[model samples]
Target: MTPVRLAFCIALALSAAPAFATDEAPPQKATNLGEVDVNARLDEARNSLSPDTGSSQYVMTRQTIQALPLGDSTPLNQVVLQAPGVVQDSYGQLHVRGDHANLQYRIDGVLIPESIGGFGQTLDTRMIDNIKLLTGALPAQYGDRTAAVVDITTRTPKDGVGGSVGITGGQFGTVNPNATLFGKKDDWSFFLTANYLKNDVGIENPTASRTAIHDHTNQVKAFGDVSYLINNDTRISFMFGATNNRFEIPNNPGQTAQFGYLDVTNFDSAQLDERQQEKTRFGVLSLQGKMGDTAYQVSAGERYSSLDFTPDDIGDLMFNGVASDVRRANRATTLQADFATPLGDSHTLRYGVYGEFERATSTNNALVFPADGDGNQTSTTPLNILDSSRILARTYALYLQDEWSIGDKWTVNYGVRADKYNAFKPESQLSPRLGVVYQPVDGTTIHAGYSRYFTPPASESISPTSIAKFVGTTNALPDNGNDTPLAERSSYYDVGISQKLGTQWTVGLDSYRRNVSRIQDEGQFGAAVVYSTFNYDQGKVKGDELTVNYDGGALTAYFNFSYNRSVGKRIITGQYNFAPDDLAYIQDHFIHLDHDQKYTSSGGISYAFPDSTRIGANYLFGSGLRRDGIVPNGDTMPAYFQLNLSVAHDFNLTSVGATHAQFALVNALDRTYQLRDGSGIGVGAPQFGPRRGVFLSLQQDF
Candidate 1:
């Protein structure tokens, strides 16, 4: 059956099923007198403008997420695209403040380690209750990845037995079916959500292709959480999630064969079929309790991910004279513990320790022609080469911080952390963080902070440099021994102020600067668009962000603007990843980073009418993304703008639960824009943004 038809049938079946009755309200238990309850002292403050230490943070609740034109089917990355200082990439990868692949993810205060790179988003936003984007000069508790910290709080068990089923479909032969179930029973509670998606436009289209071929995807995802309350002061919970996805790599048509072999002359690139598959699963067990004046929580988790890429042999060999089938398997395990205590009336001390172990196995099957002295293909009989290896990566970190209050006007937070990593060599560093918040009057806050950051190389992308097999072959490149990417160490400074204009209006401004001895970024290379890690010898970044927000009972709106500049002094490692001329130019002059954009802005207005109807409109604007030119990264794509609109209606059924239907229009203007130019410095393929589309969804809740 077609995806759209299947989704329609599922929605019909759900509509026909009888709605389950809501559970009765639980009886209230009497509280003991003269007893004080203490919970975990995590910096649990939800306010983004609170007088907290360490730079700026943005928090988005479920309501805020739903208010955006991007619906519940959106992934966490799409939601983050609305934030300041974030840039959109062709592969759905996000770059924060000019830094790449440096974001850390946490769920319910437990860390989720990095997995193999693929086209699927591992974390679904439907299961999220709230998300916090912490950036700028980070606190010591935030280590490893330092560009940003994405902390996600999952939806908790509902007060009664309830569930929701929904289906969404739109242009591009898209279909999505999703469901959520949650309930509470005495001391035990559980929540679960599952989603399946099929779409014709799985990945971005080539800028010149205009149309995509062999680009379809089907994905399955599920998430679950269960908790048992041992008592009011102690609790245990288990969480697990899985994602399985398959994609057909899009093709560019009408390409003549670079080499004309016997009996095969016309090489239509569109006929070259390529595919990728990925499977990932993870689980976490956590326990939290309070003992006397101290609070503690501990968590342990393991994750496994595997990716496989298959290439079309005939087309690849005819055009590029090479084909590589690759497979990667990865496993990660983590253990973490946190403790918090109140010291006197002026200080609150918090500390944590974390340890992780990762193992990755990579295998590549490559077929290429035997080359002549001039590096020209000579043989029709393909030469077969096998490359395989396994590596272990380990990390350990410890941190301590104190939130000290001095009178009513000033607050200071200070901490230090140490991290050690074992991969290429034994590498370690110490980081210190400090932040001060001043409140001169009511509804006003000013903050300044500085941080020393140390980021270890990504475990999943690193491998020993092996240049012997392809040295004299068609896939040859000048190879040096120092090919592995290096760690990054930097110093960051930030300042910001937030003020309330009235009861419903607020505005804020923030600025930051970063100086680095080593910078890290990931880039796609080769025909497969395989990602590899590389570094800049030295660099600096500067940016500023402005935000204005207004909330009036039924009306909500926000506007944000950001300006950024990122430059690298020289190429430090993995020269094989770049073209020789571009590398030479970068070595001689300061070069703009590939993901750099001069200006980015986003704005939205949402209103809820009294008639149970809602409307929202939003827009995203960008000056341009960097591209290749006479000099490295000297050109950029044309500026582009996109507008989105959404409308929703909620109907209350007297005998059943409420039902909601929504319609959305994406890229309302249908502006055609390119995300990446094919010839850019370090860009492997060209991609264009989505065109205009109309989408609809229906859901029923009980």
Candidate 2:
């Protein structure tokens, strides 16, 4: 279909969706609502009956996630990609609204500090009860990481005991087993989940082959929560989770080595055996209570993470003639307090304060040959050198906002935030936020807003690796100086409109623009999976999104369209990671960011049969991702599309409760595509997308 024709159809669907819900009862206004101090709660109520805020937000429930064609093995990133203006990259990271590493995470409205980067998704999908992705211009309550807000809610038991166990297997020698238990006994309640996974395609294939060499992964994760009620309005809770993972870096065969020294022997790059391992653990203790119209929540948490990478010593020495064994670790402690209360009648107040203390250390062991005074001949024997550094940082933040209801047709929210960080230097900023919402009729809502954002550099992102030992090796790059990347500060504006046609259809449009002084980004420059942060002198990003959703009882579906452009000018620091020619080309002109993708669209439709049978399908389309040539990010990859299908049946048994079985086909059409090109700017490891695969899963719940 033509673009204009497709746009017309989407508009029609949005207008027709409400017809399905016309038979349903009308929404009821809360009683004694003003007395409830709605702002005091963690977020919206479980039923989502709160007032509208001027921001673009998408919510997914556990049922919605399970119904996707990916079945039980889907990761959080894949689920998020279904949203507009979201794209997948080489690593497991998600780029939202054309910004890299700008997504912040929260559990039950409490911020979780950034942890060490890893190839595996730290939080398991099986443990999540609901997820919210808030984008565009945000209110004062949301600061730092202004690109997007990922709020996750964990499952909690309201009554008697229940649990489930399942096993899933698929192509590429994949095997996974998981279990979950949740329930309440008197005043005490608990929920727990654990899983283990092993797969052949742990990381993307460096070659175009269907399977990658030595690319295997083993991972285990577990989460547990315990809560006790002291009174009807008071409670105490504790939660903890841990993850361990190991992966072998995929290799490309028949490739020439990049290094040559005194003829020790022939070195092949394709025979490399590289590996990476990560271990992570975290815990949180919280207390929540309410008095009259006032509510409060206090929390304390700690997180520890470590990563180790081992390169193929023999192959690396023959190719680059230098080998490195690297390790890094981080420990973070935090304290947070949030409170909400109702003032008189027309206003509600909410405020919070947060603090974090972080400690980090990096170590590298490199082996290189020593050169003579003439620099003509070097000893074949290798010399071992060490480089290590340890540093500490602290960050503190405060936010306050007031929600005012003006008459019955308009609502306004205004507030400000202050943040300070101590690392390379002391940096701080005061940000102001304002949003206005208008309701002309019963079914239509319009919103507009502006916000100033100050995002401090993540401790893990700015920490420099020890490169002093590689000055004389082939792995060395032109180093002008060591200048730490500055924090990103920007101004954002957004506007949106949403309308309900009748009952089954909902349509919305949102647009946003951002102007930044310094753009912060990270990339891998060595054989390891670790990344280093760098800066772009200036940047501008603009995007627009359209969404149509339908809920027709037996059938549910959604469609999303987004177009975005991201451009940067000049490189401020970290010149050693880039090619000299590419850097020179971009110094005087604006170039597309390495992660930029011009157009993205996603949609899915699912139907449930009366006889316990269900089927669903989904598709993804991308215009193209950025590529690098002699002109520095002046090229683009070929556009590609992907489709997936799934089917399942539910069985009710008298003896075993309920049983479910499902089968899924991913990349069902077997389309081949490249996710990254090694020749691209800032591209470390080239990788291709997965080929066709079939998977099956079985589960029982009681």
Candidate 3:
């Protein structure tokens, strides 16, 4: 059957299912007392499904998040950058352990499907109660996109009703307003949040100037969660989220035109009016309960995302000889179940199953000038062409693992997982994982692990260009082959140790290495800021990280440093996206990936006073990303650093319940740096970092 028909059938079946709850009177206090016990048991059961046995886990609580320069207003990607082995890049992207864009996100122990690559932020920081970043060799339950795992726990209300409203605005024509409401009564609980933002610096600037030309954005996001307690041992919950964002494509002025369109020849590059729109909606429904000695939870989820790129016809034709309007959309439906049960005195068994179905579509309307064999334009008038494609794919996975405790000093976990993917082609794999944790002394811990991984390319972002149809046009390519992206298979090894120096300080060191075949990576190869995936024949990546943390009565501090090296030998897929000389050189020699940075470091310190006032500061440093030299990715850009500071205070008013205010200084040193030079393989345009700015916010809680 077709994907459309399958989706329709599933929808019908879900609608026909019987409801689990109805209108009934609130339970008594005795029942609520029993619920307290069940909630703790459920939390423990959920924690067992995702074990961080032999991985490097970094956690940030709600208090830590609020202590940052921007507080809840900081983007999720920026928050993750504070962890070890995370490198920042242009367009709000993060590379962990020398791997490009392979992170998995989970909320409340439920997986959230990946969306198409874009410049907008989908998940808001305000909804997070606590966030954890897990890296290195992982356990058996984690599959697919495994560069890192972002595990998040959402906020929940205490008891009564309460809410907050806030507004933040600053330089660069910025304004933001947000509100949140949460409450619990009897057996029903709910939380909801909404926000709107408008800013001038949406995308990175194309030059080193203080302000970017034609760069502005408007965005709106909303999320809701509701749950009902069926009894002392069972509950049902539902979650939904939505985001709509629009951005203007930034431009670089003083560029000479290379081609003419119709009667127009000279056009101002800074005045070009190009825009992009992104929208996403997702929902998940879950059922949790316990029977006998087994604990289990089942969930169903769906997500839809779309992006549209509108081009300036005359400006684009004169600049690059081609003007394209692109539209892409993807929809996914998923089902997951997990169970944990204790066998004897020394063993705990955990198993799970997952399935997903996805459909993606792409449409392109392009106008191109007629060209000769020498790639010289022969006609001033442009003609239009329509190119479109669609794909349907499915994935299934099953895993089983056991955690065994030998004694008080040692623990081991071993498991295996099988996965089958049916997309443009069919593929299957069976991977094994093993991990050991040892505690030899007081306040000292050591861990070692090895894992085999199988990763499939993102289905929503794979759209092959029709090379033959563009021949004899200005949009033609120099190469001929267009191979489909393949799955990546790899072996990973990791070792780490953590020790406590005294009562207030702790330090850790970790090292990891991976050897991969058919390794996957992504890049922006078009005028639109969308990414495409490709494969390398062989890849090797290695990294080491050092971390130190301190916590006293009223002061806190942390520092992290990482060194990474990543190289790929051959471009086995997506040949049309590379030049012949670069491909030949890479086939013979190893070259660094475009997003790889050799050294990265971040540190922060915060202090709280007795008068309910807090002062905080943070710093970030990078050795720089790769650029083009004599060969592909042979040179690096200049190093750079940034500093930020914040001050916040609480106030109690007689008329209002409570109020808070904050002031922040971003990029305090006013340093200028380039993130991309637009000269490497599959690089599209130049981009620079943000300049200095000041921001202020006020909030009222009741």
Candidate 4:
């Protein structure tokens, strides 16, 4: 079936199910104490499904989130930048621990399938109550996308009917409005949030100018959560989220045309019109309960995402010899179950099973001019070529682990996981994991871990190009090989230590290394903004992170620094995307990945006054990503820094319950920096960082 049909059928099934009815209990009176008790029990059950073990974890609570410059209004990608070992890249991309876009997301201890690649944010930060970033050699339960795990716990229903409304606007033609509603009745509870945003700077400017030409965006996001408490040990919940976003592709003017199109030899580059639209919808239903001394949670989820790129046919053909209108979509359905039980007095056994079915579709209508054997355009007239493909894939994974407390000061966790992928090239693996945590003193703790990992490339990003069809076209490839991408197999090692000084200061240091075969990476090789995956014969990545934090009664501060290096050798797949010289060079020598950065740092400080006022400041620094120089990815750009500040206060009105106002200054120094110079392998265009901007917001709660 088509993605649209599958999505509609799942929505219908979820909607037709019985509402708020419980198998074990009828209906009971709702009280504040009863509600609190039920929520606590459910939270405990959910926690049992995930175990941190010896991994490094960084947590952001609601209060800390609100202390940022934009508070809950901040984009989800920006919010994740504050964590350690996270590097910021163009197009709202985050690379954790020297890896490119391999993060997994979980909501309420349930996995949420990844969506198609796009510039728009699929998940909203406003719905988050708490979020944690888990990294390093992960446990057995965490598989597939394993560079980082972003575990999010959403806001729950309040005691009574209540909601908040807010609006924020600033420079760059920005306008944003949002609302939230939450309430509880009897044994049923619900929470909902919706927001709309319109802005002039939807994407980073390609040039260093303060504003971008033809760059505007409209976005809408909505989320809902509803749950019913059955007796005291069982609870069922449903969550749904949706996002629709549209962006006008920013243009860089004053460029020379390389190719000529029919009757369009003198077309201006600045007058080009290109646009992209992105849409995502997802829903999940889960049941949580405790039988005897064992706690279990089962969930079913479905997600659909699509991206469409409409290009200016004549202008693109004249500039780059090809004009391709691209459409890509993916629909995924998942089922997951986890259970934890105690064995004897010192061991806890945990196990889980997960499965997913996905359908990925790609449609491309490309217009290209005929070319000669010498790669010169021979005709001004363009030929229309249709390239389309669809793929069905399945993945299954199972894990079993035991957490053992050897002594009062030492703990060990060991496990094994089995995974199978049935796609273009079928593969399977059995991997092992081990971790140890020790407390040598009252104020210091140490942890070390090792893990074997197997990661498959994203199904939607693996549409092999037909090299033979475009042999004599302007879009012809330098090479004719089209090898399928293979799953990555790696061994990871990690060690860390954390120490507390007095009662208000804490510091930590961590280091890790990974060695791999058939490593996977992605790049933008086409006019569209979507990414495609490829493989390398061998790869190595290493990184070290340092963190310091202080929390006093009314003051808080934090700092993070990371050093990373990633290199790969031999282009084993997707050979058509690379030039013959670059491929030959890579096959003989190791080269740095395009997204790697040598150094990164982020820090923030905040203070709260006695009069209910707060002020905060934060900064980010990067040594810059790799670019083309003497060799492929052989040079680094100049370093850059950004600073931001905010101040907020609360007011009590005679009629309104509470009111809040905030003012923010972004890029306080108005520094100009380039995120990309359009010269690296698979790098599309030059992108500059945001200039200075001022923003203000007001919110009312009832």
Candidate 5:
């Protein structure tokens, strides 16, 4: 069925289902708490003026996600798109800060994947508690991303023991279920969430010679976080996570012969499969003790992480039913220490020094299948054909920062970091950051800052520079070596102002520009150029954003809008112009160049029922984004409207407190359309997915 038809059916079925009974009582009053303003990851005192994390900061509140617009119970990737500076393309990638592709992704301040590259994929957003975007001057402890930074901190239950399960099923055999098990007690806490989604599809928006094929995906994800207080002055935490996903895509796209006519059944569908798995484990121990007349902190940590991807078949070859296979792994360990001091009453200073050691290995092999003349199945690929090789990459970093007090009305922050990569030879770099803030009155501030960044290329994308014969070789060598390389330098400059109008409203404006000298050929370097694991030259990007928020005890709302432009090129590629304008695998001169969007203009009204039940209705309107250029010359789709509702009630059961039952109807008005496309030709069907869906939750506090 066409995506539009699917949206219509979903709308009809929702109207027929029992609507959540509205509780007409006034909403319960609320107040923001804690110095760790989650949205901005800043102190409340500092938040009073510059409150919105809207531009450089992106947040996905759990309350808002449970009521998302997609048909399947909400996925993490879907929630991420709700944040400004994030864009999704036809192939399910999360592009942030205008695709200079300098995205440094991390968890609790540790370098993941070990290589200079990032692990790219669509995550189930339900598994996350918070998502933070750092467009400029990311903390000193975080390193190696040339463009921007993304940090994810999982949720740890606030109440006693409880859990919730949700399932969404509709057009195209989409079946996705997610569940969470968590609990918190006295001084110790534990949390866990597990999810899986698999669906089949029949191709549409057919190209001239392309045939329809069946496609299915099986994805499973799990996350757990446990923490404990060693004492009033100390705390320790540990985290374990896993992601296993496999996609059995439809038939491959290849000509029957290099110079022959097109054939639809030329490749097999069942023969195509892609498997990816990642596992992470880390521990944090921190002490809040005093070192002198002022306060201080000392923390230590150990971490282990791994990523493996094995693609069994490359093209679903009909001749031998065998294709190429590849594998890669990275592991690391580190010792960290930090200190915080006060330069004065008005100015507080914080600085940290840290070191890390990492080990990594990569392998790639292509099997030769001696198939019969007509392309029939023979024996399985050989095990002895193992052409295995391993290499180790090393690195260490040191950083320091000072949060200075300009006076009772102004503050300044400046810091610098240095890093060295030890492999083949040693390459070193220094990154610097500077920021200034001024508070003119009780709850208002204007800030400006600039920072330099560096990113090394991923291991897979780097080719070895030198190789010598291990054994006797007359045109026959036992092994070939691959050298690792680093991505060039990058930098950013930002300026903004924020102010609290009074007791109920706040607004802010921010602008930034970033440039990277070296990009990966695929993940970090000119990764999109020449299809080699090589590096590309100079690329530039810039953008602007604005945010506003209003809250009055019983009511709260926010809206964020951003504009951006990105350009990628082969400026200094040894006089080679493979595709000067193209950013990566995408067409040149044509980039996700510009963007504009606004959100959360909607409002929520909650009423209390006589039996102690509450109901809420929230209206939402989202602007469309482009993976191609922001303004298409011919036909440009603007924006659309949507409504969502949620209801839940609590009742007394015993002295320990009873349970709460809840349900939500997302995308009250199902609107199906394409969101993004990496291709400039616009040949793809605009990127299709599900429409509206339902969700249910049950929780108990004891």
Candidate 6:
């Protein structure tokens, strides 16, 4: 964007901040509406209609996430695309809105300090109950990751002894098996899930011929929460969970273009293997108290994680080294207290504050490998690497939110969070969030919201380790700078309207904006041969979205559209980096790339039957990702459409196995579309993705 245009937008945004401060209406209690608040991004659980879900906090209910189809369950990055205003970043990192990877991933609030080459951490979705993508500012109640925070809460067991076991097999000998167990009582609940699997790839990369890969993985999670009633007004609660993962990529190598592909033909490539392993555990304990019209709660938690990684290759290092093994360990503790006091008969004031302490350490095994003049590998080195470092930090914060109500017509929600870190750069920061809803009639409401939040640098940037082989010397390692601070802040604005339209119909429309300062740029080239990790300049983005939804008796439907206008300028030199680009998807149609959904659209419709039988279908269309057509990895995958359908029969089929059975067919049309070539080094993979597939299972409730 031009300097003049940017300046004008900022001016207009500031001037419009206080234009709609409305608090003169009756507050509507979500007692009946199974509505999820899009504004509270972090607190949408209240609007959720299911009791089996964790809400009023950052909780994801299993029923919802389990229903959404997630492709490539290996990498944790691809699973979060189901939410609004969130998308995967360039490469494989996730970018909340336009936010960068200067974010953090917490397992039950405990931090994971590991770097998968340039990718973030490997996430195990099978053991996850829900994932809360906290992209905005760090709420006072939580610590770390300014631009956004992703809280990955693993599945906890319920009160019964029932678990789900599943196996998904596709092209290239891929197998994913998952299981979940839940146990629940009147005052206690527990949920647990375990998954193990391995995959053989067929991504169309030029190096697909010379590689031999054998990868395996395992994930285990346990959750248990109990609430005791000391009396009627005073109660105590405890929630605890543990999670573990192990991934291994034996010997992943693919030939260069000259070596030729191993398989004559495939949907993509049948070679190229990726291996890794990770594990984490975390839990929370809290107490709730109530006196007269005052209610309060206090809680504390501890988290620990251990991760191990061994990559097969980088760029075209199809030969030479065996593997770059690395390990990361971290632990975190938090203390928070909050209360809600009644203001009067018609209004209530709520406020709270919290303090937290976190510490984490990671060690990278230094590697000694043979290299050519350009840092490309040629030969040598059996075992040469060191893994040990102390990386720690702490934070403190405070926040207050008040919901004011008048007679009937409008209400306002206002809150702000202030945070300060004990380590690294960046000063105390604040996130101010506000929202207003005006109900002109009983079935209609006009709502608008805005928030200002910033993101700090990520854990990886604080200290980076890299090893290089000089032309004549044996091996030398260079330190990635700690000079760049994790300091990036953004101001966001959203406006939309909602209408009941009657008892069976509802609709909404929304638009948003985000401008950030001091975005962390890890140079243009990813893991540059000479420079391990560096910093870059500033960036800006503005976008709009439109959505129309309808929910009725036996039938419900959804339609959504999103578009963004974004650009970045190099601080070192004012030029655009074309190689990696922004948080955009390239293999949109190829291999069903999720990020290509940008400037794209989606719609779905379903109906219910009287005998617990229902059927539905969905449609996806997009503009397709853009790519450098002239480059070797060039070639933009076009847009595509996928159709899916399923049927469930609820009956007393104790004879079959359990309570019910579901037979599902994915890629129902048997229509196979080309996915991105998975072996993307510079330009990315060039092969076709998966093909038509099927999945089946049976379940019983006790």
lDDT of 4 by residue, 612-672 (tens): 9999999889999999999999999789999999999999973656898988898999999
- Full-model lDDT for every candidate: 0.77, 0.75, 0.82, 0.84, 0.47, 0.45
Clashes of 5: 26
* Model 2 local distance difference test score: 0.75
- Residues 1-702 of candidate 6 have per-residue lDDT tens digits of 456644443332111100011111224332221233221221222112111000011223343333334322334553454333444333344544444444566554434433323322345565576665543222233334544456665555444455655555544355656655666455455555545554443222223332224433444544454555455455565666555555433332343321111232221223434444555566667666555555566667766655555553331122323234455655667776666565664444555665555565655554445545544444433334564556566667777766666557766666777877666544678787776656667755555556666554444334443333223212333222233345556666554444455565544444455565654444322221111222234455665444455556677665645565443433321112222332123212112112223464555565667877656555544444433444322445555555555555556755534444444454566544443433222233333323444544344444
TM-score of candidate 5 to 2 decimals = 0.69
Best by lDDT: 4
Runs in model 2 deviating more than 4 A are 1-52, 261-263, 369-380, 465-468
CA error at residue 14 for candidate 5, angstroms: 41
Worst 10 residues of 1 by lDDT: 15-24
RMSD of each: 9.9, 4.5, 9.5, 9.4, 10.9, 8.6
Question: What is the TM-score (0 to 1) of candidate 6?
Answer: 0.71
Q: Write the per-residue lDDT of candidate 3 for residues 1-702, one digit (tens) a residue.
A: 246643432222110000001001110011111335555656655666677666667888778888888888888898998887889888888999999989998888888888778888888888998888878878888988899999988897668888899988999998999998999898888888889999999988989999899999999989888988898777789988999999999999998888988787899999999999999999999887676566678899999999898999888888888888989999999999988777776677889999989999988788889999977999999989888888898999999988787766777888998988889889989999987777666666677778899998988888877877778988887663655788899998777777666777777777778999988988887676778899889999987787877888689888888889999989988988887888899888989999889999988998999998999998889999999999999999889899999999989973645787889898999999888888776678888888998999888887
Per-model TM against the reference: 0.92, 0.92, 0.94, 0.94, 0.69, 0.71
Question: What lDDT tens digits, residue by residue, belong to model 2 across residues 198-276?
Answer: 9999888878889889899999989898988776667788989899999988888876664444565666666788898
Candidate 4 vs. truth: CA RMSD? Answer: 9.4
Question: Candidate 3, residue 393: CA error in Å?
Answer: 1.2
Clashes by residue pair, model 4: none
Comparing candidate 2 with candidate 5, which one achieves the higher lDDT? 2
Per-residue C-alpha lDDT of model 5 across residues 230-284, encoded as one tens digit per residue: 5443445665566665543333334241111123334443354544444444454
Candidate 5 regions exceeding 4 Å error are 1-55, 58-73, 90-92, 100-131, 139-141, 146-148, 151-189, 192-215, 250-265, 268-315, 318-322, 367-391, 423-425, 460-485, 520-534, 571-702
Worst 10 residues of 4 by lDDT: 15-24
Candidate 5 lDDT for residue 544: 56
